[model samples]
Every structure is written in C-alpha cells, then in structure tokens.
Target: MTQFAAEMIGTFFIILLGNGVVANVVLNGTKGNNGGWIVITTGWALAVFVGVVIAAPFSGAHLNPAVTLALAMAQKFSWAKVPLFILAQFTGAMLGAVAVWLVYKDHFLKTPDKGLKSAAFFTSPAIRNNSSNFFSEVLGTFVLIFVIFYFTNAEMGNDKTPIGLGSLGAIPVAFLVWAIGLSLGGTTGYAINPARDLGPRIMHALLPINGKGSSEWNYSWIPVAGPLVGSALAALLYLWLRI
Candidate 1:
C-alpha cells in the first residue's frame, strides 16, 4: 500500500476500535455496556497495536499528528511529508468516527444523555479546568513521545531506517498507552494524540446524532495544542540528550 493509504487505513482501525469501545460502554444497551474504564483503556491500547501492525511497514504508522510532528522535529522523518501524513491521519479518524456512529446508531438514540453521546466521540476534561486539562494532556503526551523516542532509539541510526514501531514493536507501545490511560487518563481522557481527538470532535459536530449536544468547541483546542507542545518538548529533549 502507498504510505498515505497505509496511514489512513491504520488510523481508521485505531478509531474504529478505540471509539468503538467507548460507544459500546457509554451508549445504552450494548453488550459491552458499562464495561468500565479498564475496558476502554484496553480497547484503545489494542487499537494502537492493530493500527501499528497495519501501517508500520509502509508508513511507519505515525497515526497521530503529534507523532508525525515529533518525528520530524527529531529528524527521524521528513518535514516535507508531515502535512500529507497528518491529513491521512485526520481523514482516517473522521471516517472511523462516522463508522462508530453507524455501528452504534440505535444505542446512541437510546442513550438520551447528550454528554454520554459526546463521550463516545471525543475527550473531555473530567473536571472542566482549562489549565489543569491542558497540563494533563501535555504531561500524558510528554510521556508518550518521550518513551517512543527511547523505543525507536536502538533501531534508529543516522539513516533512521525504521522510524516507527514494527509489528513486534507495537507490543511495548500498546503497554505504554495502556499505562498512560490507567495512570494519567482520568484528568483529560489522555488525548495524547491530536488527530485522535480533534478529527472525531469535528465529526461529532457534523453528524446527526439524537441529543448529541454541544461539541464543546471551547475546550477543543486543549487536546490539539497540548499534544503538539508536548511532542515538541519531547523531541527537543531527545535531541539534547543525544548531543
């Protein structure tokens, strides 16, 4: 597959299963209903594993814009390709969000709670403090990108041959994500990836779901900006450490 196609398809699966779990848990009357936070976190980690397995060969599976940005800053990926990769990630995420809505349409209608419906689509701060919410996202993503730097370090040389996780590499990454969710996700839902949140948030606004309520545009920037900032910091630190 072409890199763009690989990225798009990979991220599609990420959201397909990631958000899919949320819908199954939060939306009404599903088999996985009330499966709880562990289920959601596990689903998301597995979703990352699946996406990485699919895209690692062709695209390196930089499935999140934050990841793409970090690699470029760290000189592990091409600056010229950043925009294309990010576009594919966002496109895939939006498509995946639509797929989740379609799969859970009946439950969405039955749920009746607008916030619950929104929860299935994107992250929201549990406490609604903008500063804390931003800090939570930053710290969560800092851990993500920072650890990813070390994960790739052994294989990454001057040529940067394997810039992202391989199929086996997905295992550690999955555990890393799961750990982040279990430890730090409570604050802002740990939207450590920008495309993972914003693309779906946009879809939540556009799609016609019953009682889906406000998309919370006011709080939307935190997820996007926080991860990007976190990524930059991680990349800079990695570079400094190497020097």
Candidate 2:
C-alpha cells in the first residue's frame, strides 16, 4: 500500500479500538461499563499494536499527528510527508468513530446520560478545570514521544534486522502507553495524540446520538495543542539529553 493508505489504515484501528474502549466503559449495557482506567489503557495499547502491525511496513504506521509533527521537526522524517500523514490520521479516526457508533447504536439509544453518551464516543475530563487538564495532556504526550524516540533508537534496529523486530518493539511501546494512562490519564483522559482526541471528537458532534452533550468546545483545543507542543518539547529534550 501507499504511505497515505498505510497511515489511514493504521489510524483507523487506533481510534477504533481506542475509542471503542471508552464506548465499552461509558455506554449503557456494555460489559465494560465500570472497567475504568485499566481497561481503557490496555485496550489502547493493544489497539496501537494492531495499527502498527498493519501499517508499519508501508508508512511506519505513525497514526498520530504529534508523532508525525515531532519527527518532521527533528528532521527524522520528510516534512513533505507530514501533512499527508495528519490528513490520513484524521480521516481514519473519523472512520473509526463511525465504527464505534455502529457497534453501540442500541446502547446509545438506551442510555439517557448525555455525559456518558459523549464519553462513549470521545473524551472529557472528570473535573472541569482547564489548566490541570491541559498540563496533564502536555506532560503525557511529552513522555510518550520522548520514550518513543528512545525505543526507536535503542530497539528498532537496523533495516538489516528481521521484520519481527518491529513486532517486538511494539510491546515496550504498548507498555509505556499503559503506564502513562495508569498514572496520568485521569484528567482529560490523557489525550496524548492529537488525532486520537480530536478526530473522534469531531465525529461525536457530527454523528447522531441521543442526548449527547455540548461538545466541550472550550476544552477541545487543549489535547491537540498540548500534544503538539509537548512532543516538540520532548524532541528537543531528547536531543539535548542524548548529547
């Protein structure tokens, strides 16, 4: 597949399973309604694994706007490719959210709680404070991108390495994601990926669901802006630290 196709396919699974977990937890009549933090984290980790497995060969399977932007800024990836990746990711994320909606259509109709319905499709902070929520997103994305660079350098291995190494590298990355979610995800659901947070959010607003609440418009920018800034900061820090 082409790079664009790979990115879109990768991103599709990321949002599908990532937001799928939220739907499981927050929507009515789902088994995971109260599964809480652990479930969401694990689901996302596995989702990343699935996406990477599918798209790694073609596009390196970024599936993340923050990752694409950071690698571009660091000159690790071609700047020209950045826009394509972001567009693919956003479109894929929207498709994924549509899938989640289909999977839970019955539950959405049965559920009367607007907050719960929204949570099923997207993210919102448990608390309403903007500063704390924004900071948490930034910090979370910082750690995510910084660790990604470390792992890429340490374990991605040379091209001479077997394809299986890519699969193996995913484990540590997945675990790191799990760790971040367990620690910092309480606020704003640790939306450390711009595409992951915003794409599905747009879908929630556009998709028909009963009793969905205000889109939390004021807070929406935090995840997208925070992760981009945080990833850049982390990239710079990694360069300094490596030196």
What lDDT tens digits, residue by residue, belong to model 2 across residues 29-117?
Answer: 89888888788889988888888888777776677899887776666677887888899999998899899999989988978989888
Best by lDDT: 1
Model 1 lDDT tens row, 1-243: 988998999999999999999999998899999999999999999999999999987887789998889889988888999999999999999999999999999999899999999998999998999999999999999888888886555326334344655423788889989999999999998999899999999999999887889999999999999999998998899989887
* Structure candidate 1, residue pairs in collision: none
Candidate 1 least-lDDT 10 residues: 153-162
Model 1 CA deviation exceeding 4 Å by range: 154-160
lDDT score of residue 137 within candidate 1: 90
Model 2 misplaced stretches (Cα beyond 4 Å): 154-168
lDDT of each: 0.89, 0.80
Cα RMSD of all models vs. native, in order, equals 1.6, 2.7
Question: TM-score per candidate, in order?
Answer: 0.96, 0.92
